[model samples]
Target: EQKKNITYVLNGTTQIQSYVKQLIDVTKSWNCSDVTYTTVRLEDFFADIKEQALGLVEIYHQKIDWKAEQSDKKVTIAYDPMFRAVMNVIQNAVEHTKENGIIYIDAKEQDGRLTFIVEDSGSGFTKEALLHGTEQFFMDDTSRNGEAHYGMGLFFAKTVAEKYGGGIKLSNSENTGGARVEIFFLSSQETS
Candidate 1:
């Protein structure tokens, strides 16, 4: 039993290490302000993102209940960066949320705007995390050795949002009484 538990923890640690490497690669290549944007239909985009998020859920070994709608509406944005940014938020939730905690995602678009909200049933953000959570390398004191987190997840996500005239907000989820993050974009319309 000890061996199995050790192996499980090691596997989880390996997965996090891999993702951290991916995050580093993203930062090295990110030029969010100048990246090329792609226009995609909402339904297709949602489908693709949902699949990726689910993959993260499995990798992190957590159960998440996804809640999002389909739309024929169109959005023009940087696909890779935006996708990674959204995933970062979801990944943060997966990491901080307890082993059996429930995570929730709500994706939506309205009148040329798009938003992705992530919520969790874990201990929500600290008082400090709420104010400067999106700042680079702003990990809380409780962070493990400051190695597991460089505090770039939400920071990168917020940067991507601003690149496309959007923004991000960190708050406590009233319903779940846990951390909630909303990444949103505005004026994402294409001209005919």
Candidate 2:
């Protein structure tokens, strides 16, 4: 019995450490100068984001549905940080949403900015959350509803946006009755 218990404890510890390492690997910080920008088509980029979102939802067993709209008009964005920010938004939606929730992702270019919008059918942000969501280590129980979140997702997204000449906006979507997060990236030329 003593040996069996020891084996079980070791296994559990190993699993926990592995999980933590995986999480760290996903959200590792990047220096702004280390990121290189290259021209890429917007539709393709949105498709990649959609794919990543779907995979995360499935992995976490969030039971959320998603719809993605790809821009028909061709446009290019050169900011590499956009990918990390957009992924964080989608994952945030997945984690906050309850079962059977829906997430909407839309990408478009306007006024020399490429905007990516993610809306989740979850309890929208409280006023406090809206105000401080992007602050590092800021988490409110009312907004996330006791989810296993470290509150770094939005902060990282905000950093990515600010580093690339854009910003992040958080709101409650009137149409979806849920949380809406918009991340904008500067135009290709402005990105560099």
Off by over 4 Å in 1: 1-34, 144-147, 190-192
- For residues 111-148, what per-residue lDDT tens digits would candidate 2 score against the true structure? 76878888888888999999999887787876565854
Give the per-residue lDDT of model 1 (tens digit) for 104-187: 999888787788999988778888999999997688986522346666788888877777678999998998888999998774
RMSD to true structure for each model, in Å: 4.5, 4.4
Candidate 2 regions with alpha-carbon error over 4 angstroms: 1-30, 60-79, 189-192
Give the clashing residue pairs of candidate 1, or none: none
Q: In TM-score terms, which candidate is top?
A: 1
